[model samples]
Target chain A: MNWKRLAPPLAVLVLWQAGSTAGLIPGFKLPSPLQVLGGLADLALRGMPPGHRLHVHVLYSLERVLWGYGLAVLVAVPLGILMGWSRRVRDWIEPLVEILRPIPPLAWIPIAILWFGIGIRSAAFIIFLGAFFPVLLNTVSGVRSIDPLLIEAAQMLNAGRRFIFLKVLLPGSVPSILTGMRIGIGIGWMSLVAAEFTGVRQGYGLGYMIMTARDIQRPDEILAGMLVIGLIGLGIDGGLRLAERRLVRWR
Target chain B: MALHLEIEAIQKVYPSESPEGRVEVFHRIDLSVDPGQFVSIVGPSGCGKTTLLRIVAGLEARTSGRILLDGRESEERDRRIGMVFQDYALFPWRTAVRNIEIGLEIQGMPQQKRRSLAMKYVRVFGLEGFADKYPKELSGGMKQRVAIARTLVANPEVVLMDEPFGSLDSQTRNRLQDFLLRIWRERKDTILFVTHNVDEAVYLSDRIAVLSPRPAAVCGIFDVALERPRDRTGPEANRIRKEILELLHRPHTSPVTF
Candidate 1:
């Protein structure tokens, strides 16, 4: 709502338009903002490849991210709680996590395609890999960061092991878990786009649409696709922040 | 109902990196609290006062000791024993009333019953409007009140307080002391309170036990027979405070029997 916050980007856009008009910027390399906006209109009305609309591509991307990100949260949270709660579980799993964590999600694309073939499954698998570590590591740190005094206080109240885990550890680590989830989804969304670039069986994805645009030398459409990706990423992160605020209102 | 608590020949030793291989925090620390009596343990800093209370509360292990509750050897993690920590230790996530209900919830009491019971203490502690507020929203005095209410609502046989008001400003401390006295008078709960303030000990305790420096042990026990609402700066209270301070200031030597 603040005009001051809008000024910098507006000024940059004006300068970019001026440079493109002056022929100082090559249109073949990067299109002006107006060209990208026109490309967005073309994608919405005429479709990227004449029949596959921009909305369809967005839907496909969202579906893959949901499947992957959901599975990552389901697995990582409980496993993370165990690893954080018990040194035994952590000792058993930590080495494996360490070995796997540093490998980029894109690096897993070849193996994922080999395992699941060129479909949503391979794309989802890559996203899952991208999301898993952030959630897991954050959850571990969340549980560990709890003050020992709070646990002792709960114990003094005669809280049993189950009660301690459910009431104390779970609630105490929620803020950290939410943070990890936000980061995880961000990474997962990014990985989904990259995985689509490798190959998608359905022929419907933002990355694939951009690839088609590149094949036809449509730089404006490519930039438009990138803009959509950026905006959606911002929306997702903003939604997560809102959820975090609601859950951790005590802070 | 009130209960008698007896700590017999308690000792604590921690492993050390030094040549001695172990550090004796305290040795043969003995004390007893009669039913409905308020007892205070006052000692110098790092004299193992908090450790002693933790042992009594079964939160920490003693190298050697027996904690007898109403003449029976108390079991580990005794539910009948409750503690109020110096930092309040209120769960920041829970509201004031919910924090008070924690003990009852652990006992598997029905939600409605615990809520009503916790509400009663919220009023009793004068935490009326703040019952639904979280710990961060409350002041230090309010948080301590919530902490005390949290411990007391469960009706533990004996309450162990480790400097519960130590973090509060002087005025809040005095107000809380008076608040505690009123609650003690009404409930007649057996209490073992630990504090470093000689005046606080003199004001609140029915009996004050003084502990010497580490390898701490009870060096003196003075019966404060002063009347209720006793003036803090009064002659008798000051005299007893002076005596305890003198005992505490005396150089660390062999434990002296009073």
Candidate 2:
């Protein structure tokens, strides 16, 4: 059914290849399409660093997102549920979340490095900041938005509080929570570039590759790194779409 | 038939700070139903027919008065009770069989046992081919069938239906009415059907209770003495329909479908 959806992207790719071959795109600041492709192959075979592969950079970025986003889900979902269920918890936690959420995640990087000492922990912390609020707010709204009649129906059918929570509330809020996860992942990806810029002092990732390439005026490598990041982000969202289809099929 | 349920002096007050201090949705509403009876509550839109049913089903707390089941006051909903909502409320994430399995699952029936029981009702409701389909995948009529099958499979002592067919088109509504009559006759299930449609109330109910405007009270209760599978266009049916419409003076207030 989505076969027609591919046409626009393909057309853009064709135009990009044509523009590159015709030298219509400036070579100094941008790479030709073929040069970018070649750059990708070069990185795959022999990476920017001594022994690391292209997959390593990708995995580093992905692993950071997984840990950060996973931690956000783990922490925020329960807190959101508690806030949704009880006025006391909501009132207590509301001010803190509201205050902290508005500040962009990059603002926290310097403090995160000071707190976490500049490595994977620091990167994960910043990404977590980027992701936590979306999941928390969405879960809260999801739980709040449940049709009360559904809960009443469950109770009328003899469901205990625990059963109603697990069966009625959780399933009812799933579509909303899934929406939160999608948005959270995108933000997590965006923050990955900034998070990795925090001077890890060891192996570098795609973000570091882009930064180092910019210093060397190798836009080809920068474009290739960006392509990988974009492609991987697309893949992650694609996985979520598949899960949305499987888990929330009725919607 | 034995007296099955008695709702006595029921009152519901929606807390408000208006000049009257609080808005009373309904008060001192008294009614009783016998076992194996089909009763319909018909009224204008705001007469609280639904609120009365929900109170009877124990989904909402009554401000005062007692609900007697088998001659004893009890606030807890009977496990042997089921309700069909106006929206069908089929749990969009579940298939037809799984939706029907909720009641049994709450009863702690084993998975295989519940599945088979659901399958049986799927056939009973002529939902054979659509059992595995999700609620959105089915037509309006089909979804309503699944909702009914879900409640009937519970083998409830009383089934409360709140404008269940209000969402269907006229043709589907008539067909479902016939299908429901067949099922009701076969099981002799006690039902408290709520609606605003005078024709529907007069046609399906053994006793039709007319409800007055807000702070809903039972205006009157008239018995339908016609034979089984009563003709919709028959003279007696027509007379009862007209009488019921006149009784529910704020008539033709069909609840919005979906």
Candidate 3:
């Protein structure tokens, strides 16, 4: 709500509106904000390329990211906590995780396709790998950074290890977990684009629509698609930030 | 509500820089605390006062020792042991009240009882308005008070504080010292306080045990014998401080090992 923060984006929007109105950009290459909004409405009402609406594309991408990101949190967080808490766990998994972590999410797309075929499952697999390492690494770092005195205090109170994990460890790691989630979401968003371009079908993700527009030489529509993607990503990031502020009220 | 503690021939040794040697921190330490006694251990930095306190708290295992509570072995006793750290150690994610209730919650006290007991300590510490506040929102002194309250809220038989006021500013530390003295007077719980501050040791403790530096051992024990409701600025307080400082300044080489 701070006007200072809103200034830069507002200025950019005004400039974009002015440039498009003055015909400063080639019509074939760029679309105005108004044009993109109109295109968005058209896409919503009349569907994209064929019979699928914008909601269908969004829902398709959302479902894949949700399942993939959910699985990553489920598997990675506990493993990360264990590794962070014990040197033995870290010794066993750290090298393997470090090796796998450097391989780009896009690099996994071919392997994912080979393993799951070109479908929602393959896209989900790519997104899962994209999201997993960040969350795991962050959770481990978060747990590691916790004050040893806090653990001792909990122990003095006779809180068992299980209670300590639930009551102290999880809540303490939340800020880092949220950071990892934000990073994972960004990675998932980028990975989804590469995932859809690899000849996947029946899934109406925006990445697929954008690629189709590029093939058809409709660059303005492609620009519109890209704009929509950016805005949604911004919106989701903003929503997560708000949620982080509320849930981590203590911090 | 009162209990006795016996410490019999405790020792702690750490690996020395030389691979072939071990440095003894404390050797053949012996002490006893009568029911409701308040004792403080004071020494220079790296004196292992904290190490000894940790051993008594059962947070650290002594190299060799026997700790008895109420005439029974500490391992077999069901006495509640509470600790307050120098950092306050309040769970940042929990509210003041919840942090206080953590010990009782761990004891599996019913939620209603935990809340009720937590509320009592919260009010007792004059933290009524800050019950829902997080550690970040509270000042350092307030956080320390909450930490003390949290440790006492479980109705622990003995409280172990390792330099609890060492992290506070001078004025805040002084205020908390008075607050702690008032609480000990009213609650009558056994307390073992560790600090390098001779003044603090004299002000709060019924007895002050001076510890030698690193490879530490008890150098001397002096009973303050200052009357109850001891004042920081009073003449009696000054006398005790002088004695404790004298003990702390006395030099000693390696302790005689068995």
The local distance difference test score of each candidate is 0.94, 0.84, 0.84
Give every candidate's TM-score on chain A.
Answer: 0.98, 0.93, 0.91
Best by TM-score: 1
- Tell me each candidate's TM-score: 0.98, 0.90, 0.92
Q: Arrange candidates, best TM-score first.
A: 1, 3, 2
Candidate 3: where is the Cα deviation over 4 Å? A2-25, A31-38, B76-79, B231-235, B253-258
Model 3 — interface RMS deviation?
A: 1.2
Which scores higher on TM-score, 2 or 3? 3
Q: Write the per-residue lDDT of candidate 2 for residues B230-253, one digit (tens) a residue.
A: 899999999888887777775434
Model 2 lDDT per residue over A101-181, tens place: 999999999898889887778888888888899989999999999888778767767789888888887888888888888
- Span of ten consecutive residues with least summed lDDT in model 1 chain A: A193-202
Clashing pairs in 2: none
Candidate 2 docks at the CAPRI level of: medium
- DockQ for every model, please: 0.89, 0.60, 0.75
DockQ of 1: 0.89
Q: Which stretches of candidate 1 lie over 4 Å from their true place?
A: B254-258
Q: For residues B1-258, could you state the per-residue lDDT of candidate 1 as single tens digits?
A: 999999999989999997999999987988999999999999999999999999999988999989999999956777799999999998989999999999999999999999999999999999999999999999999999999999999889999999999999999999999999999999999999999999899999999999999889899999999999999899999899999999999887768789
**Alpha carbon lDDT at A139, candidate 3:** 92
What value does the lDDT take at residue B3 in candidate 1?
92
